[model samples]
Target: MAYELYYWDGIQGRGEFVRLALEEAGAEYIDITRESGRGRGTGAMLAIMQSDGEALPPFAPPFLKDGDLIISHVANILLYLGPKLGLVPDDEALRYVVNGLQLTITDFVAEVHDTHHPIATSLYYEDQKEEAKARSAAFIKERIPKFLGYFEKVLNQNPEGSDYIVGNALTYVDLSLFQIVEGLVYAFPKAMSNYRGSYPLLAALRDRVERRPNITHYLRSDRRLAFNTEGIFRHYPELDIGVS
Candidate 1:
């Protein structure tokens, strides 16, 4: 049976990470909210969410329905699908390591969201523009280097090789790292202009992932949504700060 991926229709949001994995693996899945047909679309997803019969309801979108099992959260969904999709290592110990990396990515993504919505998600960006500028400045000055540098270090110290983040083989974590770098560039081009120089290994990995046949095809296809302000990585010219 095809996996049913439930995520908001318009924006990539947290759903893009899961999409990257499914795309890279060439897995058969349905982007539930994006389709228009019987048993598809956002309403079908919300019905499942609002259903009282669902004992284990997900708090938000980006959840995956596989057979009778429903997996929520980006990391949890990836963990569940990784082995099956051949996007994770066979080694038991290495799987945990990759999960840790993914959780760290989750942390980084939350921080990225906070840059634009520092005060509250309920408030509009215009309402909290000043606070966002401050938050984004600090994020660009300190957080970006801290997180990206750590990943670079991880790549540098990997016993397997610097080609991939964890093991020698490609994993979902690598695909996620590609998404992270891509989003960062979209949201803060000036700030990330030196990313190639600062994080050579990661830059190389991003290039490698982009050159992959499946990823290349996805990038050119309509399925790959363009980055926009409505999405998590919004580019408000005012919020961006160049690297100091």
Candidate 2:
């Protein structure tokens, strides 16, 4: 049976990471909101969020329905899909290593989200622009380097080689890294460009992930949503420079 992916229909947001992996692996799945002609728009997401069933629901978008299992949380979802999709090795040791890397990625993602809404998610960026500026500064000056450095360390320590994050083959960790790099570049072009050269392995991995046939096709197709302020990683000029 095909998997049922439940996510806000609009803006790639967190869902894009899952989408990229599924597409890359050529996994069969149905995008629920999209099929109802209610996906791919912000309205669809608003409806999902406002629904009373959300609390008991998966807790967030990017959840997947596989047979009787309903899974949420990006990292947890990947942990479940990685094995079934053959994106990870069969070895228990290697799988745990990849899961550890994934949890680190989750930390990085949360920090990224906080850059724009350091004060509170309930407040709008315009209302907390000043705080966001301060947060963004810390993120670019300290957090980005630290997280990137950790990933670089992982790559360097991967005795298997810097070609992939786990063993000698492609894994969900690699895909998550690609998403991180892409999101960072999109949300902070100047900062990302300035520091990108320092991490050659990560840059190469991003390039390889993009070149994969499935990813290339999805990106070129209209299915991919362009990044904008509506998503978690919004690019505000003032926030980018620690002003306003």
Candidate lDDT values, in order: 0.95, 0.81
Which stretch of 10 consecutive residues in model 1 shows the poorest summed lDDT? 235-244
Q: Which residue pairs collide, candidate 2?
A: 9-40
- Best-fitting candidate, measured by lDDT? 1
Runs of candidate 2 with Cα error greater than 4 angstroms are 37-56, 242-244
TM-score of each: 0.99, 0.90
Candidate 2 TM-score to native: 0.90
Q: Please write out the lDDT profile of model 1 over residues 5-105, one tens digit for every residue.
A: 99998888999999999999999999999999888999999988889999988888889999999999999999999999998888999999999999999
- Tell me the lDDT of candidate 1: 0.95
- Residue ranges of candidate 1 with Cα displaced over 4 Å: none
